[model samples]
Target: MKEITPNNTNTTNNSKPMQQRKRKADTLGYDLNLATSSGGETAEKGGDGPQRRLWVKDRSKDWWDKYNSADCPDDEFRKAFQMGKQTFDTICDELSASVAKENTMLRDAVPVKQRVAVCIYRLATGESLRLVSKKFGLGISTCHKLVLEVCSAIKDVLMPKYLQWPNHESMSVISDEFETLSGIPNVVGSMHTTHIPIIAPKVNVAAYFNKRLTDKKQKTCYSVTIQGVVNANGVFTDVCIGWPGSMPDDQVLEKSALSQRADGGLLKGVWIVGGCGYPLTDWVLVPYSQPHLTWTQHAFNEKIDEILKVSKDAFSRLKGRWSCLQKRTEMKLQDLPVVLGACCVLHNICELRDEPVEPDLVNEVVDDDDDEMVVPEVALRSEFASKARDTMAHNLLHHNHAGTSIL
Candidate 1:
């Protein structure tokens, strides 16, 4: 899978009569909105008599006017949308130029605040597009359009500022912090790979099939992978998203743009700690896979677990804060990456601003990264990495930095 990239959106589902484009495609697997709106102010559809002014003028303002203000005044508001009012404003300000539109003679364009709110609320709650329309007082099709638009804006506007590799100076700070936390030197980041469930596409079903997860659950399942690298503070420094779910962590890493960066010598001297699933490359250090480990090796593995927890806890908070990542979304398989990228950017903002996730919302993240044991070939297992791991392990025990009490 590749990282976030802008894609085209066709939001032509208007209030006009049924057209060919409005009809569902053969491959469409979900019922997001076969009953979607036509967007006219007085439009009505289905069943009994007329239903005028669908989901407008009542729930929308009471929900919007209060929470959309400069002073949020309620943690309830934060629950509704994942971030504070100020943080909301900051995102709006950053994405204003991209998402903002001028009022037309026929109707008003969605303001930046409302647009951003609609998008984030949909993601934070994982509600259906129909429910999102009702909550925001928008047309179902319009809600879908706004979501796609805002996600594109976040990827184009906010991602570079919020989710990017550290500069040389920042890398030094991250390395020092990681060393302090895990007693390992020259380790700037902790890496983990996790999968997000998705509705199986009619085309390429087998490519997206998660055989390992499906067998574990005893039912058919599908997903796409997300590989993330986090600093000591649990902020993302790099990411590879939207790979096929069937691919293991090592294959996913090999296919990622991150490996290209490493190949280009971006990670020549430093190490990023990963699980045993990854090969022991010169720039990547993984736990020892041998069963009969020495005391020094065992000590190294324990410290490596400490680093892995940073990535694990970050993902838990990420999925906990924005629930959309936790379940299969009705979004198109092609468009999933943009929305996932938006969630990652928002997660970074929340972590940077010290926004606390509601305790009850936290879900147990089960990453099956260690499903495969590495029997590394010579090319995969670098001599340099082996020596570096040994040196770090010996220092941890001899220098009194090892965990003292095994009892």
Candidate 2:
């Protein structure tokens, strides 16, 4: 071995420490300048991967502007908004002032027309909030808020104007129309209940679960009932929604405000026709359920069928126009009622405006058979109502206007 000098020893010690540092750096993934130089050379030689563009162009503004332009054709407007341009403008004119007044104090608030348009598009198409937000160029949470706000406004303002209990004169007109349409006399309105499917509620999930098995494997679906009374024109005059699906139709009626009003003599002499799912009272008339019916009973049932068509058609038109009601809406259980109520209001608006119904929507209406709940003996014994039904049946069989055949 060579003799160890101080300088040599110092150099050897420094080299060992430097080598240990390099090894530690390598283990920790830290390059010792060689890798850095190699990377720089590769970049300069154009061997680096493609660079990603960071900025994306937003196209929502162009889409929205195209749809909302004044020169936009009426047909295109109808396709998007589900209403004619005239109707849309009318509604916007009515709602714009109030929406503007409400948003007067907020800076960077969305325009009223845009807000209303977004809400209507969401309701009309039943698109998801995320999709609608992307289409309208809005944040998801903002879209939800705008939808709720606009629906509340519609319920508050348009509902009273469009959907209201008919007064004496209005009832007379509606009754005359019904008689002309179906030969059903003294009919103020036709009543029916439809199930609006919903997501299972966090609270009282069982209450929302419909006892009627909707699937092949006996799986019960959840729904809420919307009991509506429509006039001969298929316009809803009275609506009672938010009832749990598990509740029977008669129970829903019994707990309804209409029932209370009818019981308190407020609806005295005003008769409304209901299906077999309802209890026959003096004000509410139902068809005879007994077997071996007479000619008069058969005639009565036929006329009742004709009258009930008004309600069925109304529901069809409603669900057709607002497809959201047809689907299981992804909304909170409590919020669903408001959304549905708004749909009803919009339905009446469309009907009053004579908006054309789509041909395919007519086939979408389901002819659901109601599971009749057993009525108590005491409740079924309505002698006066029974006599009223008999009298009407007798007249229908005898008169036979429009050559209505009982065969």
Candidate closest to the true structure, highest TM-score: 1
TM-score of each: 0.84, 0.81
- Per-residue lDDT tens digits for candidate 2, residues 1-407, read 12222234445554666556656754543423321121122111232442212111222556678888988998888778788878877877777756653333212467888888888888888888877876776656667888888888888788889889998899999989888876767889999988888878888988888766365226667899999999998999999999998887888898998999898887777689888778889899877777798777877888887888789789988888777777778888778777888889888888999998786875775534334544434455478888888888877777774225756
Any runs in candidate 2 off by more than 4 Å, and if so which?
1-59, 101-107, 213-218, 367-381, 402-405
lDDT of 1 by residue, 204-317 (tens): 989999987787778898999999999999999888999988887888889888899899999888999988778999999998887798888888888898999899889888
Deviation (Å) of 128 in candidate 2: 0.7
RMSD of 1: 9.5
Model 1 global lDDT (CA atoms, 0 to 1):
0.80
